[model samples]
Target: MTQAIDRVRQALLQAGHPDTIAMFAEGTHTAAEAAASVGCSIAQIAKSIIFRSGETPILVVASGVNRIDRAKVGAALGRKVERADPAWVEATTGFAVGGVAPVGHLAPALILIDEDLLALDPVWAAAGSPSHAFRTTPADLVRVTGGSVANVKA
Candidate 1:
């Protein structure tokens, strides 16, 4: 398969995100790295965290500043939540940990968008590669991921 970044770019385009995918010379493997590269606040970086709910993968689109409360996740999903390992993250999303986008999954997973992101405009998210990012509004993210708005932050 081609690089996951390309798939992310296509997904963004197809989902009607206003901005194109941005690739930095420096890798955005972490929210702090992406923040430094994009000149945005760390809070403005959206991280896609995948957790296993039995057989299903749940993608939590959260702000960099917040830690996902797994207990809250369980409450939201009404099931036990298990963290996905590196191999599972890759196999489920077709992207590595630092590069998972909110869309273009190999299969659709239930998504939860952190309510914190809604307070900020023009947040940046991983574009299927550690070196690529995309600018998007919280509304667009909800649209692209078909995510539900929730307080998943800790």
Candidate 2:
């Protein structure tokens, strides 16, 4: 398990992202759990959510502080945004739903970032493991994940 995490970290580095990844014994399956483990506000955690915009998969890195504004998302993209099922998440990301990272996925997705994350300097994100997470700036995440800054949240 540690070796797998190391690989994920290496992938992040190879992708030109800062290597500030951290692992923990407790699972970061939820924002509250991650906030407790990382000792940060729950709002600082970025939830890597996969939603289906028609047949295409769009990845939304939303702030833990707010939920996605489905109507706004639909309006911006011109398609209805339906929350992707767990199976779809696994299929698209190669990682489980709760542990999905913004990068190193099995398939590329249309990425939209929560503009609110910009207010938080160092944002916590999943690290390809349920028990691991990392802190990095939202701008760096956008660059590393090839995501665009957008008003993805309500």
Candidate 3:
């Protein structure tokens, strides 16, 4: 496994998560690709989106079928938020934009999970590499990341 994948595995294990990371040769870089690979609905994919509230990084794990409402996010944070550039995302999360996991970020972030994800029993998230992923529940995501569930869907 790559170092990025290893870090994600370690983080999952430390958090007592039961599933192991799965690497796909074809890659899981997009939500559509990930859902197709995993044989699940698009909504079951938890896509981690990164944003910046000034110098602080924010992670929003939203359902793949939904688009995030930046206004709602800003309301929640009580501040304006902007999309993080690729370099900033990598610097803050220790993973590239396409492979940022819900947990195991390099720096602490205010994480917000879409409440819609909670309706799904099983969810998939990126595992620190474009080709890696792991099965998990929304509740597990909240537990591992210490994130709040909100109406993040647009």
Candidate 4:
């Protein structure tokens, strides 16, 4: 496994999550690709989106089928947020944009989870590499990341 994937695995284990990481040769770079690879609905993919509020990185774990409402997020945080650049995402999360995981970020971040994801029993998230992913529940995600569930869907 790559160093990024290893860090994610270690973070999951330290958080008491029991799921195993799965690597796909074809890659899980997009939500559609990940759902197809995992044999799940598009909404079951919990995509981690990173945004920037000034110098701070904010993580929004949204359902695959839903678009995050930046206005809502900004309102919740009382700060305006913009899409983070690719390099900033990598620097902030210690993973590439397409492979940013909910946990194991390199820098401190305020994490927010989409409320829609909570309705799904099992969800898939990126595992620090474009080819890696893991299964998890929304509640478990919140637990591991210490994130708040909100209406992030647009």
Number of the predicted model whose TM-score against the real structure is largest = 4
Count of clashes, each model: 0, 0, 0, 0
For all candidates in order, the CA lDDT equals: 0.88, 0.82, 0.89, 0.91
Q: Give the residue spans of candidate 2 off by over 4 A.
A: 1-7
What would the per-residue lDDT of candidate 3 be over residues 1-154, giving only the tens digit for each residue?
Answer: 3777888888898989875688877788899989998889999999999999988998999999999999999888788999899999998789998899888888899989999999997999999988899999878988988898888778
- Estimate candidate 1's alpha-carbon lDDT, on a 0 to 1 scale: 0.88
Off by over 4 Å in 3: none
Write model 2 residue lDDT over 47-101, tens digit each, in one string. 8888887667888898887888877777777778888899988876677877888
Considering TM-score, where higher is better, how would the candidates rank from best to worst?
Answer: 4, 3, 1, 2
Model 1: per-residue Cα lDDT over 1-154, one tens digit each:
2468778877887877755688887888899999999999999999999999876889999998899999888888788898999898899889889998888888778889999999998899998888888999998999988898988888
Best by lDDT: 4
Model 4 regions lying over 4 Å from their true place: none
Q: Give the alpha carbon lDDT tens digit for every residue of 56-132 in model 4.
A: 99999999999999999998888899989999899878999889999888898998999999999799999999989
Report RMSD (Å) for each prediction in the order shown.
1.3, 2.0, 1.2, 1.1
TM-score of each: 0.95, 0.89, 0.96, 0.96
Worst 10 residues of 3 by lDDT: 1-10
> How far off is residue 9 in model 4, in Å?
0.8
lDDT for predicted candidate 2 compared with the true structure: 0.82
Ten contiguous residues minimizing lDDT sum, candidate 2? 1-10
